[model samples]
Target: MATVRLLTMLPLWWSLCVSSALTPVRLRTLPLWWSLYISNALTPQALLAEWQAARIKSLDVDASRYHAQVLFVDDDNARARMAESCADALAHWADAGWWIYPHSCSLTEDQALIENPRQEAILTSLGFDGTRVTAAGAALAKEDLDAYDLVICADAAVRDAVLALGEESYETSVRLLADFATVADARSRALFDGLDVALAERARSRQDGGELVVEGADAQSDRDGFDALLESTLVLTAALVVFLKDSFDASFTDSFNGLLRTHFYDERHVDARWADAEPALRRHIVTGALDPRERERLFDAHMTGLRQRLSGDGVSS
Candidate 1:
């Protein structure tokens, strides 16, 4: 009696499996059957082409709605936080002009916010809502790369980390934030030039060969060195913001590609390429203790100077 019952249930199970495989709606819910069906129905090449088409369509829709969607990645949360604060400072542009959405993440596995007392104090003084700034604990997901119009890395190492997680196709979208500094603009060029000199001097002192090496606070382990690093990151964040605003203003009607160009530092020459500039640049940055109004005033003054220089109207000292 038990054997007969088992035979009867086997036929029913077989029928159900066949039915599930043939039903389109059921296939959508069943991963195993869906994979088999897709494998039998389409070639791998054809499937990839379909996926590419869908991605392009989604990006087109996103572009139509916003001027640009950007993702900023860094080793620590400081750069990410600074990027958010800088974006807030430029919020007025979102009214009728370009709408920029900035997202941030760290390369570390732990998502817990790292403590940066100085950076936190500076941002707090700037009048930005602290609640709005939070960094992701882990690196960005590979599949989520398509969501951003651009993935701007804080430096070459950050860029490399991002690229390693993403496909080769994502290379075009990933770029060094420093690359957008607009070297043609005098103010921006001066900032980067000072950084290069500082980094070069430090690099030369440590090595005998005429090879250029770049070291950070990790190498010097001094309070002033660390402060210089923080100040440089802040300045770069501001400079990139200025560059982005100018790009959008000049190409208000252009496509995302038209508004931005693809630029990266050569792999062999990546050392100290985006490291912080000298402390002199910090004069333009608001960091020390100050009232909110004063902080805002100083921030505005720095941005105004950057804008003027980029626009061909030299800023008067």
Candidate 2:
């Protein structure tokens, strides 16, 4: 009798597993019986494997596919590493058919693979493989610029270097990474428009407001400066992902944005605050009054609210 009952529940159990894998929130809120069954029948590694497999299968079926190559160029390669690492973590760019290449405009051939310990640590903490970071063999050449579907520069200086290679055609394909965030929407534009002022204020507070230096005199100060830079890079890369995903499929942008938002902000209560007091939050963002930590928190909240609103419109994350 017990064997027969177990056999009868197998189909239902499989269905639940599939459903939970596709929508991970369901796994968290499973009933007592389901939870017990999962614990007894599957190890943690096995469950994770199941979930990953399900996710891959679902992604395979997505009609809105992307197949593009992207190159990230920067002076020391730190920005390029952060851009690729953050994009991989937040957007699953590899699975989405994005080929991301990182290059350094200043490093020589011998120094191409040298890693920045601080930047590597940050990427590793964010669940990316720091070993994967690499610099191009040579400086930014016209041939290199022409190879990629899009060439993203860390700043105006890097952009100018690529432009100096004397190819008018490079103008259309190459762009500043921050430009994506600024033009993404009203909120993003407002936040980024004030970013320079905010960064300047931060530098002045540290008593080193010249040339936007990220290094400091001491170890702790150095870490703090790098942390601020990393946060800025991650957020900017996220904005670029938003723009690309929206362009991939205008019809499903809401769903894609919801998924992106959940990756950035997972707190339900925080999402509620943004939904409740958007105008007040927008004011702070526009004025650059919020410090780096505060700015990240509010931005996460606002993006999370965007997810909720889109989900309410029948789009699932």
**What RMSD, rounded to one decimal, does every model reach?**
22.5, 24.6
The residue-by-residue lDDT of candidate 2 on 1-317, one tens digit each, is 00001112134677566456545465568887887676655643344335433432232112233434667777665666666665555455323334233333432344344447655654565556555543333455567766666777776666677778746556667666654433333332232322234542442332222222221122234666575565555555655555555444442433333434544454343344434544444442222322445444545655666678768877664
TM-score, structure 2 vs. true: 0.44
Mind giving the per-residue lDDT tens digits that candidate 1 earns over 1-317? 00001112123565465455556675567688666866565543333334334432232223344357777777776666566555544443323223566677777655325656665654555454566453334456776578787787766667777888885678777765544322223433233322334542432232222211112343133545544444444344445455554455434333322211111112322221212221322342222222344434433444444445545644332
Per-model TM values vs. the true structure: 0.44, 0.44
How many residue pairs of model 2 clash at the backbone?
0
Q: Which predicted model would earn the best lDDT? A: 2
The lDDT for every candidate, in the order shown, is 0.47, 0.49
RMSD over all Cα atoms, model 2: 24.6
- Reference-based lDDT, residue 308, model 2: 80
